[model samples]
Target: MKAAVLRAVGAPLTVEEVDLSGPGPNEVLIRVVASGVCHSDLHVMEGVLPYPLPTVLGHEAAGVVEDVGPGVSALRRGAHVVVAVVPSCGRCRLCLRGRPNLCTAIRGRPGVMADGTRRLRLPGGEEVNHFTMISSFAQFAVVHEAAAVPVREDIPLERACLLGCGLLTGWGAAVNRARVAPGSSCVVLGCGGVGLGIVQGCAVRQAEPIVAVDLWPQRLEVAARLGATHTLLAGQEDVPALVRQLTGGGADYVFDAVGSPQTAALALSCLGRGGTAVLVGVGQRDASLSVPITATVLNERAVLGCDYGSAWPQRDIALLADMYAAGRLKLDELVDRTYPLEGVNEALADLKEGRALRPVILPWGDS
Candidate 1:
């Protein structure tokens, strides 16, 4: 099987004929159909996030099952599924407590299976690492049955792939983590794929005066198209003050999809009394946020860290798929373009250059 492998940090992914292992017990083998290249993957390539080298990088994907391993009664051959990055083990305390997004079993790191073993190999039998345990950069993948979340066959896998990560992160942030209430005011910092999802989620919850902030006017325009009541091009004016004015005093919530100390500070200033700031983006590996202590105590403001939008993948991924079918979620619009597996680096370049929003990788036979 052909796959894009990151042999070193700050290097381009090399497409090679890699060897993939069959699914073990309670696992499923999927023929990769559509996979979304996320910013998180870019972070790994740029060394913004430290990851093991020689790994296949891709997490957001939807595919069809080719075979099922032992103890995999929940899925079978020909079943369509979305691959979840966080394959929560139900027996873990976090999963049992309804917080599978923070499942402790995997320990929030990838490159290995649940049993902590590599399933990929080079030509000479050198072990290759897996990214997020759902390396969909290849033509096929072997994942735990729990990672293969079933969706209605009616929905196209190309769009459904976004629900695996970006869309799910944004949706879960607004609806689950933030618990956005109807008529509430929201300020979304960043209008990338995930930020747009947050805007749509807020819209579904009836959030009034949705203010979207982004450095790109093009993205802001798309944000407006997808339920943003107002769009602010970052650095033009006092964005914090404008957010307060648009929300009729101050925003009830501010979601910083561009994770950084700068954006965190901006979010801190865009909040009302008792408002919350949810950091949803992945910044540098050593990034740290500095919150104002006095203001936080006096104004009762909060700074919350969001991991994949605090999502329980099984439930939220399916719900997002349904929401899209119901015309409430914007999936097709979020996809800026599609690329072949060999064009993985170009896809990442487009995203980094702001030429695309959410680029999906397809099996264009260049693999």
Candidate 2:
């Protein structure tokens, strides 16, 4: 099989013919169909988030099951599935507590399988690590059965792939983590792909006066089309004051999808009394947040940290698929462009330049 190889930090990925091993116990082999270029992948490629080198870089993907290993009874060959980055062990403390998103099954091992072994290798027999359980950048991926959530066959893999990462993170933060009440005021910071999903999620909950703030006017425009009642340009507007004005005092929920210290602070500033600030983006590796204790105490404001939208992959991804099937979710609009496997680098470039919202890569397609 051919896979994209990241030899070192800050290196350009090269497509190389590699050897992929069959699935082991509790694992499954999936033929890659559609994968997305995520900011996290860029972070890993740029050395912001440290990981093993000579690895395949991709986590968000959807594909068809080619085969399944022992202990996997829930899935079989020909089943369409979406790959999840947070594959839970199901028996861990977090998983048992209904917080599978925070499962500690692979704390110290982000690059390999649970048993500390890789399933990919080069022609010369050198090991190539997997990124986030399933490296969907390749022609095929071997992942734990739990990581592969079965989706409806009608929804295209290209659209369903977004549920694995960006969209899920933003949408889940609203519906899962914050649980914004209907008619409540909400403000979303950083109108990227995730922020756009947050806006849509707020809309789904019927939250009023959805305020979206961003540096890009184009994204703000997209947010308006999705569900934002108000949009503010970051550098040109007094965002917090405008949010306060739009929401009648402050928003009930403020989501920081940009994940910077600055944006996180802005999220806190946009909240009203008893409001919560949800941190959704992973900005910097060494980023530390400082909050005003006196103000928070006086206003009774709260801050919440979210990972993967606080999602249970099996439940939430399936719900998203159903929503899309019912024409209630905005999956098709999220796709800004598509690329073949060979154009993965160009796709990454587009992501960095903000040229596309969600670029899907077809591993088997030709340009």
**How close is each model in CA RMSD to the real structure?**
1.6, 1.3
lDDT of 2 by residue, 1-367 (tens): 9899999899889999999997988899999999988998889888988988889998899999999998899998999999988888779888898889999775328778866789999999999988987888989999888889999999899989999999999999999999999999999998877998899899999999899998888888889999999999999999989988988899899999988989998898889998999999986878978999998999999999999999999999999999999989998877889998888989998888778888888999832
Model 1 misses residue 85 by how many Å? 1.1
TM-score on alpha carbons, each prediction:
0.97, 0.97
Measured on C-alpha atoms, candidate 2 has an lDDT of 0.90
Off by over 4 Å in 2: 106-108
Which regions of candidate 1 deviate over 4 angstroms? 106-109, 364-367
* Model 1, residue pairs in steric clash: none
How much lDDT does each candidate structure score?
0.88, 0.90
